[model samples]
Target: MRRLFPVTDQTSADRAATAPPSPGPDGDREWTFDELAEAYAYPPLAAGAVWLRGNMVATLDGAAQHGGRSQAISSAADMRIFGVLRALADVVVVGAETVRREGYRPARARAAFAQRRAAAGQAPAPAIAVLTASLDLDFSAPLFTSPLVPTLVLTGAAAPSERVRAASKAGAEVVIAGEGPGADPARAVSALAERGHRRLLTEGGPRLLGQFVAGGVLDELCLTVAPLLTAGHAQRIADGPELPVPARFEPVSLLTEGGFLFCRYARADAPWISRDQG
Candidate 1:
């Protein structure tokens, strides 16, 4: 992968004009996992602060998925970045439907990130937080019974008691995030933050991501643009209630590999930005 924005040459030149001519853009050189990790690290946060980020991939025509799964539109490089993002997060917040459709499982402890996670006071593996209203999930699934860290079930206070009991019996923690039948997006973030999971990453199924966007809790977006195109009726990266005024975001970084463009964008009001851009 090669960086496509905030070129290193310009920034290095400005830092020390007398220094040996910096190797121009990292053209043609594949990026190491270490480099990718650094490029996508979460921004520093104050005490009790949360930084919610969404990671999704789409086709050139804006199809978030094909044939009911996102893996169809994703590439190897995108998967690499996906692993890295999971490695860096304290918890992965996802919609229940996404967990079901994608055959979601527990987040594993990656050897590459073990040291960094330990240094940050994080658990061995990031927990999977599934948002559901009815709590109609397979309690027998391994996601609940066998995660390195117990999986979390985010639901409403009015959720069915039996299902909540079932989730608890299966070893998943059920968090009440709303008063009604649905989990309120903002409440969900606060709930996770209260658990010391301040670095949040959501692998959206579009609907849940739309809710986060609508709730105005999403701080950043890491979008991978695939070169392929499928004209079918596929969801956009975020699909939900329309905003009164469209939210604006600034590009933080851009990387490309094998015809896929990986882009990171921070909320316009967020302090995060590319070093050179800052």
Candidate 2:
């Protein structure tokens, strides 16, 4: 990895003189752990609703899956960024289908982010908030029972009473965000922000990402472009009805490691316009 993005002696001295000193191995050459952390750090939260961001991985050919899951198209560098995003978030929002298909679990505290999280006044670990309309999640799963914070079930007010009751009885906080079929992404974001969760990250399973896109509430997206090409039939990262008009996003940052590209894009109208705006 060091050789992939090497820094010569002169370049190292130049960077050291210009950039603030960052702590990590091979800080002069490749992207060290600390370098990556600094590169992907989220901006400070404002007094209003939370800033929602989505994280996802896709193949070189735009396939979001290969063997019925995204794991087949992921890499170590991708996972490293994944953990960093979770560490920086105050809560993780996921779709229930993703939880069921991926066998989701609670977000455990990472040793690397202990000091960073504490310094930012964040909880020991971010909470997992699942979006479900049928309320079909497994309440007895460790995700609900063993999280540092109780799992939150975001569902529509019209969800089945029995399922909601079961979720609550199993130690999950059932939050009703909408009255229709599924939880409205806008309402869900507001509900989370109301609870003082200002830094939000959503690991979408495509369909839920579509809802967030449709809702116009997604502030930014950190997409990992995997190196492999999956020719198999698979959905795109965001799957839903076509947009009325193309949504624009301002590219914020782009980083690469071993052919995998990590790209962050913010909504066109978002306050944090760009890195230059920051």
Give the TM-score of each candidate. Answer: 0.93, 0.87
Pick out the ten consecutive residues of candidate 2 with the lowest summed lDDT.
1-10
**Please, what is the whole-model Cα lDDT of each candidate in the order they appear?**
0.87, 0.81
Q: Which residue pairs clash in candidate 2? A: none
Candidate 1's TM-score: 0.93
After the best TM-score superposition of candidate 1, give how far the Cα of residue 8 lies from its true spot, in angstroms.
Answer: 1.6
RMSD of 2: 4.4
lDDT score at residue 140, model 1, on the 0-100 scale: 91
Point out the worst 10-residue segment of candidate 1 by lDDT: 15-24
Per-residue lDDT tens digits of candidate 1, residues 103-174? 899999888888888988999899999999988888899899889999999999999999999999999999
